[model samples]
Target: MNTPQSMMLGWGSLVVAAGVSFYYAKKTINERRAVQESMGQRPSEKLDCASFLLFLHCL
Candidate 1:
């Protein structure tokens, strides 16, 4: 493929991957929030920086 075509293909692939990643991340967050609600926890509770980091690490 020519340089411009290859570059377009590369950028398109990156955009698609990013879109899929964002979709899944949002879905996972929603699922987790539901689980928290089911467990009697408030999903709307705010976490401090360290706690937020720990939560992400646990994931």
Candidate 2:
């Protein structure tokens, strides 16, 4: 692909990956919160953005 097309494709892939990661992270946080609530414990804070970004980097 030409330079502009390559750049666009790269960015598009990154956006899709980030969206998928965020979806899974949110789902996991909700599940964990539910488990904590069921056990009479308080729900912890949501996962931090830095951690989420690191996760994306690893993928």
Candidate 3:
């Protein structure tokens, strides 16, 4: 064929960029899941404590 090395370099760069993007995307999703789990627990725990305190105060 004998076209150009620049075309090959451009394709290689695109592949590397895609790999990096996929890695960061996985990491971000994992972090979000962990945060959502922790945030989901906090409010119920606080409500439980508040309800217990109110029950004792009623006596």
Candidate 4:
């Protein structure tokens, strides 16, 4: 069973992971927006729910 210290560590890791993911997502969105603006085109949406589900099943 996990002790209090272990639980705290796990929560800390989760917080760190969430922060990193948020930062990366924001950076990617900004870069993609800049590229789209320069190219005079909207960023393409290549996949929808059905394709995403298919991809999960493939894995």
The sequence of per-residue lDDT tens digits that candidate 2 reaches over residues 1-59 is: 46998999999999999999999999999899899888979745667899889989999
Q: Lowest-scoring 10 consecutive residues by lDDT in candidate 3?
A: 41-50
Candidate 2, residue 24: lDDT: 100
What are the RMSDs of all candidates, in order? 5.2, 10.3, 12.8, 6.2
lDDT of 1 by residue, 1-59 (tens): 46998999999999999999999999999999989889988656778999989989999
Q: Which candidate ranks first by TM-score, i.e. highest?
A: 2
Deviation in Å, model 3, residue 10 alpha carbon: 0.8
Which residue pairs in candidate 3 collide? Answer: none
lDDT score for residue 15 of model 1: 100
Q: Model 3 scores what on Cα lDDT? A: 0.82
Error of 1 at 42 (Å): 1.4
Model 4 whole-model lDDT (C-alpha atoms) = 0.93
Candidate 3: how many backbone clashes?
0
Q: Given candidate 2, what's the lDDT at residue 54?
A: 96
Compared with the true structure, model 3 gives a TM-score of 0.55
Ranking by TM-score: 2, 4, 1, 3
| Best-matching candidate per lDDT | 4
- What is the Å distance of residue 23 in model 2 from its true position? 0.3
